[model samples]
Target: MELQLQIKMNPKLYLRDPEQSPLGRNIIQHSILMIQKIGFEDFTFKKLAVEVGTTEASIYRYFENKHKLLTYVIAWFWTWLEYQLLYHTNNVKSPKEKIQVVIRLLAFQLPDQFTFSHIDRNRLYEIAITEGSKSYLTKHVTQDNKDHFFKPYKDLCARIAEIFREYNPSYKYPRSLSSTLLEMAHYQFFFKKNLPGLTDFANAKDDAGVVQFLQHLVFSALKKGS
Candidate 1:
């Protein structure tokens, strides 16, 4: 008689279950839709439940409260973004090109239907602006939670920093420089378009213009050797 051994795979390595419940997913999506329509400040749990065709109590079963729901939505966005970045940058060689790809991707050139609408885009920008200090959604956010959102961004910045350091060994502010570049890249589109006259540079009319402007600004700021 011959005996065969059966191997049990780790669920996380194979088909791991979602940390959130179905109701949780519904609440997150509904809240995001409502925020897109009415903005986060105006959105409420009651409204989301009604929109999702579920009771408010059902939503609470998954999320402890509105803050948790918002956190979930924000986490979902980062997770979605990480997947997109990884997919787009998988074959791109050279850290410089990777940095360029990330800049272009973040500068609103990526094909995201959810982010294309002006209303949706504005609402998201509002959330980012307020969530750091004003919004209750971030009340429970600890350093670890913040790091979760920053992981993808940090990874991209690290890659760019690596290239910068390789070219200019004296570069002392890799993290700061890369972060500033990211902010400048994003602000060129989000802030410039929404809050015109706030800066010297006029709002860009086209996505390509924003990308080109950011590319030139970042490359021009680099040290002569770098």
Candidate 2:
């Protein structure tokens, strides 16, 4: 049997849902590669259309602009990540252990990950680390927020907060800590790799040290005031 994952994304996120058609899917799949290769600032609809072997108009039929497309891609990763958290933690009986699972997911994509056909989870992770905030850090962010454009990310944070509550029901800042934990995971990697002086793990080759640090940070917080 074959199974596929579906995320019920907000309808306002696109003019046409990319998952419904091949061309739309191609726009998504190739956009990730192009954005990764050239970066989001240099990435444009015209360039993406050329890479996808389609017209710029065709790309716009699915997304209003590069920013919306970036949001869609980031949303997909967050939704998928929320699902991954649920899937991975389903069998674990301990909240501490479940949190350990999440720290790992935030730091790096695990080997032998289940593949999503139209989305490259690994590249999307890189994009999320590098370009994720650009999606929301715009002039029209208030309107975008009203439309629930960032529900996926908020949902992921909410899920982690629940686990934190599970670990220590009396904790006052589960939601804040959850969101902060996610940001630390993304920024620390970016800092260590690109701006080495900003982080202690600058000399480290992989996120093993980052993951260890997160596990310590989270557990220490949950243990505090308890």
Candidate 3:
């Protein structure tokens, strides 16, 4: 794997830094694979410890619980995504073109060459699409927010929201639209795959059609008339 970049995720999500040592890295790498294979609901530290050749006590040294680990992985993802967005869009001049770029990046399939550390970019996307909501949609969300466990995601949203304002200063729902577009990218794909009746691209095997649909939805709303 290529050493392209390192994302410094929010520290509050973990007990010991997973990037600090080989054991920590192994924990993160294998946890991602396990969560993707077993689903988060069925995943447990005991199982993860067995997979990583470590004891449950050792795993607990890094993360408070499985939920914290989940949030850490997802937070790392958000930071990685924000980096990609800035790297790709740094030179683009127009806000309209920039926002368009953002939509495509968010909704597109994982490129085979993209990666960070030893983690599989493809599996990470799968986890994000299916399990990302669990990171925040919980009774603990209030306390998590207070701890800033969600800062990376919020930061990513804020960056896109700024572009929305740049595109149309008078638009009243820049933040709402920004967050909606982000969620829509994931939800639409999930709906298309699992609940055909919920989306127009029911039979679509890829995100190409959904990307076009998002472009229409966003630009149409940004248009002065509607």
Candidate 4:
């Protein structure tokens, strides 16, 4: 039997949970592709409807608007990522080594060992690195934050922060550093790809350099009292 993973999502982000029905699944599956191809600015229900072979109303039945839909998918990614971080680190004994695993998970795609069933993990990752911030960087962010739209992201950071504490309980900025590591992973990769001039890996265009840089920064910070 092929076991699949299901990440529970925030209900406020959607009118109906898309995981419950086929049309809802289609909406999510195609939205990632369309968003990756055309981006959030150009993506719309009408276009997504055409892509998914459904009406705009059908898509709206699951999501309140494109922004909420985007949040839904991005939150899904963070939740799944948290699972990946924990699952991969569960047996590891060393806190530093566990965090190293977390960095690698954030930096690279895994060989597809299990079927995800509905969503394309690559498309979703691309959309996340590119459009993930748009989900929260809005005028309504304060209200959205109050409603816990960003919980999965915060949860992921919190998990990392806990690990950081295990490595160095005296570290006062664990949460800040945890969130910084998460954002740095995406920004460095983005720089490596498009804005190469902004990154040191312009010549090599290597994910390994990003991993090394992150390792240096993380371990350097956790090096007890500098």
Q: How close is candidate 2 to the true structure, as a TM-score?
A: 0.95
TM-score of 4: 0.95
Model 1 C-alpha lDDT versus the unseen true structure: 0.55
Which pairs, if any, clash in model 1? none
lDDT of 4 by residue, 120-173 (tens): 988899888999999989999999999999999999999999999999999889
Model 3 TM-score on a 0 to 1 scale? 0.93
Candidate 3 local lDDT, 1-226, one digit each (tens): 4336767767778889989999999999999999989999999999999999999999999999999999998988888888778876789999988988898778754343345566876688778989999999999899999999999899999999898888888788878888899899899988987888999998776778999999897887777633
lDDT of each: 0.55, 0.88, 0.86, 0.88
For model 3, the stretches where C-alpha displacement exceeds 4 angstroms are 1-3, 109-115
Of candidates 4 and 1, the better by lDDT = 4
Over the full model, what C-alpha lDDT does candidate 2 score relative to the true structure? 0.88
List, residue by residue over 46-155, the lDDT tens digit for candidate 1.
88888989887776666555554554444444344445566667787665676577666666456542332212433554454334223223444465344363454456
- Sliding window of 10 residues with minimal summed lDDT for model 1: 6-15
Q: For model 2, state the Cα shift of residue 194 in Å.
A: 0.6
Query: Clash number for model 2?
Result: 0
